[model samples]
Target: MTCMRCGREADPPPRHRIGFPAPVKERILQSICAECWKEWEGVEVKVINEYRLSFLDPQHREMLQKACFDFLKLPEQA
Candidate 1:
């Protein structure tokens, strides 16, 4: 698989299914390599903490999803 973020050929990462819909999960599996996904994990934490996000709120969840898409460089509707 080719990593969309880094443009390198690599083994796909383990499934990261939390919060994402099925199509988005498939896109991630196909496009994102493990290294970039790992990097996103670190950024995800920082984003949640920096924004004081709580998963209890629907809007917060949406914001986190947006952040994930942006960080992974995935298309908005892909």
Candidate 2:
């Protein structure tokens, strides 16, 4: 397979866990190629946190945004 992000060819897929609390069985957290996974690994924490925050209720948006910005080392938008 090819990496979705980098377009690089991938090695054999490895087993990975997804979601919380023992993780969902038979779930593939990421199916992208290895090269893409390497790039994504650098920002995994920030990306996952942002994903979680994005799904939260609207009242938490501001706080979530702040947290995400902090994690990304980016300035918060006014």
Best by TM-score: 1
Per-residue lDDT tens digits for candidate 2, residues 1-78, read: 644344556662344522222221121123345444344445656654656655456645555444433543334442
TM-score of each: 0.86, 0.34
Worst 10 residues of 2 by lDDT: 19-28
What TM-score does prediction 1 earn?
0.86
**Residue 3 shift from truth in candidate 2, angstroms:** 2.3
Per-residue lDDT over 1-78 for candidate 1, one digit per residue giving the tens place of the 0 to 100 score? 889899999988787534566777788888989899889888989999999999898899889888999999898774
Off by over 4 Å in 1: 16-19
Candidates' RMSD to native: 1.6, 9.7
Clashes in model 2: which pairs? none
Candidate 2, position 31, lDDT? 33
